[model samples]
Target: MMFQLQIARIATAPLPVWIIWGLGLVTALLLFLSVLLHELGHSLVALHEGVKVRSITLCLFGGIAQTERDCPTAMASLRVAAAGPLVSLILSGLLLGFFPTTKSIHPLLGNLFGQLGALNLVLALFNLLPGLPLDGGLIIKALVWKITGSQRRGIQVANTTGRILSLTSIFAGIWLFLRGGGLSSLWLVMLGCFGLGATRNQSQILALQQVLRDLQVADAVNRRFRVLEDDQPLRRLSQIRLSSTADQRPANWVLVCRAGRWIGYLDDQPLRDLPVQQWDCQVVANHVRSLDELSCISDRAPLWQAVRALEHAHDGRLLVKNAAGIPCGTLDRCDLGEAVLHKLGVALPETFLAASRRQNAYPFGLALSQVVDSMTATDLTEDSV
Candidate 1:
């Protein structure tokens, strides 16, 4: 509605109210399309560089291209980062070029073309600002990576610059608002706050990347799980649960074995259905699941990989395997979260930890997947830190 009003106010060739509104709607859609195309430019270049594009999202702030991984090299990053703004600049030029021709047809049409062209130009230039969460910031990262051989350092510089730029934008917006600049001023203020928030989020991700660098799955492996022979009676399983602590409690799901080979697992949930008298009648094999169906991760692999596995796992848990390809223990969402927070020097509250253990999930819904992606993109490693 605001856009339509803005468009109506801009119309000068004396057009009907409905026609002006229609044109305004079209202009709004075209603007969104322009943002989509801008993101597509980045995604296409990322794909060409052997990176998989997961999704492209159009949000209130702008468009974002979520890729599975980062480019292989600095030059590749530069190419991918520059592609979006380059496409926007080209679009601006083309639209502006067509403006005169359209204006000859109708003033309203000309106005639409002119507005779109100018906005695209602004989009290109605005995104070119050298700061984190922006194309220009990434360009800066690529350059610094090429020059100093350290992407982490590049990220630090970019983040700092982003904070400064965001603050400046906020202050500028406030000045504009005080001078009666209205909605445009508020837009700038909101954009500034958004950018500031994005920069801080990236900073936290970088910190997590530091925590995960060169860390292995074995470091965070939880050994609280029990292994039970398939022939073992449910009564025997019940006897083992007499003594447990918060940190040493046995996992609810225990690994099942048959003839010295892992067969499946048994969940404690179903055991509650039977009476105590039936405990001796049921064997572990009665409720066994196939071990092959479980999501397994190598104990020696990077911890980040385990985090990724947990992120995609339906049950949010993984069966960890040792060097001999034998099941060692398990790593769940809580375990991974505890490990990460431990490294970051942050302690989880007992209540939160208890809740997470009860639900078998990360504490406070921490998003390790996003942090892992950022870590992968920045080439963060132990040596880099």
Candidate 2:
């Protein structure tokens, strides 16, 4: 059975699918708005610091503020991060004040606004926890940087704090589940899981940044890649496998090229799901993910910045462009990993087999575990301390 259905079955009965979906949509929309306001707070502060706000995206996790440049000082970074939660808190307070002793407004709307206000309050409070990727975490990191005179040490400390918070939340969530609470308990567990994953990702990115401080995109790009025409049939490319024998398959995936320009990407998953006979009838253009909406990085962009962009975009791959806005190469997470490892003077294995395995086992997960473990390793790492 699908995970969605399994979760639904575990939830309360008498909750019809349409109603549940409606409520979910409403909640998502509300959360999106709240996150937007929060990110806007950050963006506004970033603008004041002469930092450019690139864009904002609202996803299942929350909203993110994409900035064109990093803040020049620890104080600026702290303020930029703190601005979001501060806005949330202020908005919550305003809502609470407006609804104080309310008896005139409809009960349903009042309840909704009250819940919204409460959610904002929770958002503010939760974000205040000292950890990386959180406003409070950045604030604490800034303070640590100020004292230690080391940005790396400050990030390490903040990330460690984040992992501890994540673990505590997970434990608390499990306890809540054991107590026979409903969906709210399950949601707590999921939230904790999400927080853990996000915190770990943040730490991994930081580690890579530290390792590849001066590296650029030009250092790790696969310049020679095949670009396919939109009208091409998948059968032709599938026959000519570029990789080894083990990787040979129907070439349903292709990079869309038009008028000497890289336009988009096309995958064969949807076509493969259908009957084999229907494959010839489908066009590759139909499956394309538009390049206009996808993230592309300049060839001269720093490796660390490119990695951050990939993480923020959550896309495994990005098209590398030259000065003339033409596609020059492709850069993915693996390329970034290899570059970092190479720069660190890690030995390259002789055989292709060993190299592939080593590259695949990049220390992203272990690095995160270490970051978290470091928090408990010292007495000063405790939250109370």
Q: Evaluated with TM-score, which candidate comes out highest?
A: 1
* Residues 58-88 of candidate 2: C-alpha lDDT, one tens digit per residue: 6543467878655667788788888999999
Local lDDT at 17 for model 2: 69
The Cα local distance difference test for each model comes to 0.82, 0.65
What would the per-residue lDDT of candidate 1 be over residues 1-385, giving only the tens digit for each residue? 6556656666665667787678767888899999998999999999999998989998633578998767778899999999999999999999999999998997667777888898889889988998988999999988888788787877888888888999999999999999999878987788789889989988887877776766788888977677789998987777766544545433555788889998787776546888888999988788787777778999998888888888777677888999988999888888888888888888988788878877877776888877776776645744383
Collision count of model 1:
0
Models 1 onward score TM values of 0.75, 0.52
| Model 2 root mean square deviation, Cα atoms | 15.7
Off by over 4 Å in 1: 1-14, 59-61, 98-106, 179-183, 225-235, 242-301, 309-330, 373-383
**Whole-model lDDT, model 2:** 0.65
| Top model number, lDDT | 1
Q: Which pairs, if any, clash in model 2?
A: 131-137, 238-251
